[model samples]
Target: MENYPTEIQEAVKIMYEMRGNSEGMMTWKNFPLAKQIITLLDSIPNRSEHHTPYDKIFILNFIIDNISSSDTPRFTIEIMEKELALLKEVLPADLEEYNDPLTAEDIEEELQMWRDYIDTEHFSNEEWCRKYSHYMKFDPIERSEIWEEKYYEIESKIDAELMKEDMPRGLGFCFAYWSSKHKVLAEMGIEWQSPQEMNPGVVFD
Candidate 1:
């Protein structure tokens, strides 16, 4: 790891420690993929002295994505779980830069936004259907009333239903929206604040 950036060196040390042999020897065979990753990180040009949260995210994503590629043996659930758990032990804990310090209020806000997004999209579809309904010469009056009543019924009860049953469904919606938002952030080269428990598969990796 000599001559590598300090951040890369630190990341290498963490990876090595996570896969260290019980006999106190650093064995490359313990984690062949990790070795390749270290090599790749070392080869990066003009590496920075300290890796920002975003940089570390890129490195983590690079390692995971490469290890889970089609050319390689797919990462088993156990391996993926262990790697993520071990990485959490070594990676920096603070993630304010990612704007994902979720709280009860934050979750509520996100959930509301999620609901609004869904509502808007649904209404748009309804509007399109309504426009098409006007062109229907066959029972247009009956059809239009049916569409309007359906929308009204759903709109009236959707919120109550969402917040009903101890709000379990609403909570689910919150997590769903939060997870998707985090995925988008990850794609944008930003670190995710969430632990990504629901995304156990490689699709989210």
Candidate 2:
């Protein structure tokens, strides 16, 4: 554990905590494939500092995407195995060779860029409204209309001066990593919303 970074340690703590909780324990018991993947990642040797938590991040996202809930029947062994095999095949042998390691500063800078980007006249208000409408407490149809109106009203008053405080909170390192990765991809002329397409089992939202 001393060899792992703080982020990786935290992720490992969470996975073990999940296994300890009653609901999570049941979920893990039912979906041993997910547990197996975590175990496999935990066994990787001589992981570089720069590549510290990517493996843990991958495992967490895999669990979220595949294990719908503790009570759901969505955990399918065949599908999990297929996805895992595909991921191993596609993953680069040397991830550090593909890109530099993302840091907290990089995340903050990227998020600030997002704030600036959203302030520009080119920002899509409708898309923003649609993306965050799920957070509204109203009924689905009502929430959509309400959020649309709310966003437009705020947009009109703000006049393209979107601020960082207006952004979502509690996104954690996974999002920060995704944002940094997205910036790198954009510079390379690649357009992808999620890294899952290229790095299977790794998703950000």
* Total backbone collisions for each predicted model: 0, 0
Candidate 1 clashes between residue pairs 3 or more apart in a chain or in different chains:
none
Residues 159-194 of candidate 2: C-alpha lDDT, one tens digit per residue: 222223243334564454445545544554545453
Candidate 1: lDDT of 178? 45
lDDT of each: 0.39, 0.41
Which residue runs does candidate 1 get wrong by more than 4 Å? Answer: 1-34, 38-58, 66-68, 74-79, 87-93, 99-205
lDDT of 1 by residue, 1-205 (tens): 4765654776666554544431332121224545455555545542254443344444554344333211122222223333344334333443444544323343344333323323433545345346435321221221232333232233224334433533443335655444554554445444434324423442332
Q: What does the lDDT come to for candidate 2? A: 0.41
At residue 44, what lDDT does model 2 achieve?
58
Best by lDDT: 2
TM-score of 2: 0.24
Residue 14, candidate 1: C-alpha displacement in angstroms: 17
